[model samples]
Target chain A: MIVFTMLNDRFILATNLSLMTQQTVIVGTLAIAQTLIILTAGIDLSIGAIMVFAQMTMANLVVTSEVSNVAGYGWPAALAIAAGILIAMVAGGVNGFLIVRFELPPFIVTLGTLSIFTALTLIFFKARTIQGPEMPDAMTWMGTTFKLGPFTVMTGVLVMLAMYGIFAFILRNTAWGTHIYAVGDDPDAAELSGISTGRVLFSVYCVAGLIIGIAAWITIGRVGSASPNVAPNINLDSITAVVIGGTSLFGGRGTMIGTLLGALIVVVFQNGLALAGYDQAPRVLAVGVLVIAAVALDQWIRKVQG
Target chain B: MSTVPAILSGRGLVKHFGRVVGLNGADIDLFPGEVLAVIGDNGAGKSTLIKCFSGAHAPDTGTMEVTGQDVLFRSTHEARLAGIETVFQTLAVSPALDIAENLYLGREIRKQGVLGTAFRMLDRKRMRAEAGQRLQDLGIGTIQNISQAVETLSGGQRQAVAVARAAAFGSKVIILDEPTAALGVRESARVLQLIHDLRERGMPVILISHNMPQVFEVADRIHVQRLGKRAAVVTPSKFDMKDAVAIMTGALEVDEADQALGPVRTPAAV
Candidate 1:
């Protein structure tokens, strides 16, 4: 990209980089949660649905009631946001409970929930889109722009970056982090070693839900509205980022920093290709190639043993 | 024979998996500081009995006594807290984690003060240092790098790590489930030597194995299981491997009066 942009100079602009960061606010943040679930060898297909559900919850809570034949509650901004986050966490816990109780695979479970949550969002919110004017200042605060060393940056971008740093540190230096890797590496071995596999798995899903809740908030800030129709391919995008960032889909071998870079790589390819005058087809094709290449690399690395 | 009481004993233990009977009515007695080898055929309830002792399975009808006090284990953690550690046939070591990390996989040391208390930060330097010291103390020199992942190590070295973990924490009892089944002859020798060291340290061990010569070489008393029952308890001196094998296969039956069921060695001797 650097070499290509050397002639065009379109992708090298500070303004373009800042806009790309703002554009990736939602998918990048969701990738943080995705990285965690993938580390446990689990995938969250309902991540986007969960975020949409929670964001719509926040939007519906603040919007006026009876306009769309739905009860909006119209609570205060702070209380409504908290309730949305709690709802996301409960949704995550529900996934955890079903997977642990029935011994169901995470892929199948999360796949079922993706449609469930999407339907729930439409039913509860009446499929209404809440505009920025209808939302409270606290809700759109993440979208607020500020100057940072001659570059315009959204508060949401910095917030997502901070999350990446904090989680990276936690995954590297904590006992819970090591247990995550151990459990992901082999759950039966973890159980015999005295680590409660159920508890670890449950905690992971709950934590993933928490991050999704926050991503919902960031989505409102960056997208400038709360819509159930946004980011239709969200699960695929976040997964693409994780795979491209070099985290093993097989679990227990990835890092948070790699996930952050993975998210950027996806955004960079799309942004860089656009600047180079390539159409959407080529941009999508590049990401598809990257995902396959990354997985093949992961398989080759895993075959080398440990 | 000495009049030494069993350190860990179970009476009339019964366990079933749906319609299949695992242990119909099995009994076991492990004296202190002695290697009591339990031998049985494929369906002779050997693994089932060992699982009950290790708290991996709950018996439907049983009375277990540890130090003469009745105790029932609900989980593997409870059994470990009661001073009984088990090395499962799977070895139960995380393949991706380093040797030191695997050594303290479940029980990890945290950093001191705020880092440990608040953030739950693991003190890697301290854990690695202590793990190295532990390997040295166990006389396991096959693995030198504490940070090397368990998957990169040879089969014997991985077994050594598992045995070291069991020996380090198990103060009262250590149960090894087919510790040598996947190992080569030399690796088997190292594990058998590990059993000897644990016994010399006065830790009672319950060894479940299909190897006849290995059992005869290490066992002070051999318990034969047949058709989900304690067929007979015989000592190495009174009954040879052939008799033990016959009792396991139900080809020979020894009278209760002739069985050498008592402890041949006492805890005081160690």
Candidate 2:
């Protein structure tokens, strides 16, 4: 109530609220993917790097010389997008394969991959940004806005929501979802009960990679550019959203609804702070405080319930 | 007792864990409609033997036969497919999931149409109903809510869920590793009764336990393991608790004279 009162006092209008929802697209989609990884007690620090790499792949494939107009065929925007997503999935597969086959820790694996992918992005794109006419219509289509009853919503926002809805169903009412929770809860026990823990973990990484690919597309649309430097803090931000949404960092306990709400809370906090005349430094500080408080509250809840 | 062939058997099973002998040439046989109690002192290779049968660990050297067919299991899923199910001491359940979900953790029932084949949706309603029925069948009526998370249940209830899961899915054989080690007296009795019920249904059961009275109360035949090998296989009517304990701890040895006494007319003194 106090925050709402402050926002109202600052004359924050409905348009600002709609824009805040729109702003949630990129981070929100990434959070969904992060939720899946975290549910297995795993973390991916290379999510931001993967998304940026995928976006660059999509953009450069469309703009490069003979690559765009190959074999007497016009530039294929759809092929570029598919290739970008496929690359992201392969990257995700690599992470899963190494982790599962070798039994390596997810944190260290993703940490190493983060540096590797960032270097690849730099080498491939030369740290250049693709903007304006260089981006094809198919690539920028998600950025277009559609008006709905006194509010303008971005297509990208709808796509994010759809991803959340589809995955929420899959997690709730599918055998694969139960297997995921089982593996996260107890890998040895799951294996004894006839679940292949390696297979489940490997598939989770691959699926999360596919989601990150979609997040990359959203990043391109939201920023109106495919820049190697985009979403530098997304890996941490997605983790924040997932943790704030009531998913345990230790894994095997969380909900996608909580994640969506978590993403929204982070966005709302930043937007509200900016509206209330706080600088960028204070906004970042507030988010830091919120993350700590949310986790502390989660610990308290666990103890109380026990 | 019915002259039925051994449904599952292992011979010359051996497993070593970095200089610690898990199993040293342990052999086991389970007949139909009988409870074969495997009792041993701590580190007597009881767990190692069952693990070999349940596919948790591959024996360094051994041969396993299920229904007279030679088989090698590289994974527990394969063991389950071959009609061998194990209820581990840890219960092997996801506590955060509901009772129904835990019951169908790996082998969930799916919808019949495109919703299942294409969309991969589960038949939650049917699963819940069947899980409820399975619990009731095992006389686990205390769990009023089938949808309740396993973490919220008591220790005995958790054990019941594990036993019920094994009994429902286990076809030829069910191996239980210390099913009542963590339960209260009443809970242990309930689990013992479930074991009896499984035997009555003619399903072979391999029960690994340290409790003497429970073993004497249920086992049709006792397999004493000592120093990572099967010391002797005797009936409850032939050798009493003292002899079983003496053999398991290696304080007493089984010679040809005792083997020739056919049911051992007199109980041997420790």
Question: How far is each candidate from the true structure, as Cα RMSD in Å?
Answer: 1.9, 3.8
Which lDDT value does model 1 have at B213? 96
TM of each candidate vs. truth = 0.96, 0.95
Whole-model lDDT values for every prediction = 0.88, 0.87
Give me the runs in candidate 2 sitting further than 4 Å from their true place: A8-12, A65-75, B1-3, B256-270
Report residue A6 deviation for candidate 2 (angstroms).
Answer: 3.2
> i-RMS, every candidate?
0.9, 0.9
| Highest TM-score model number | 1
| CAPRI grade of model 2 | high
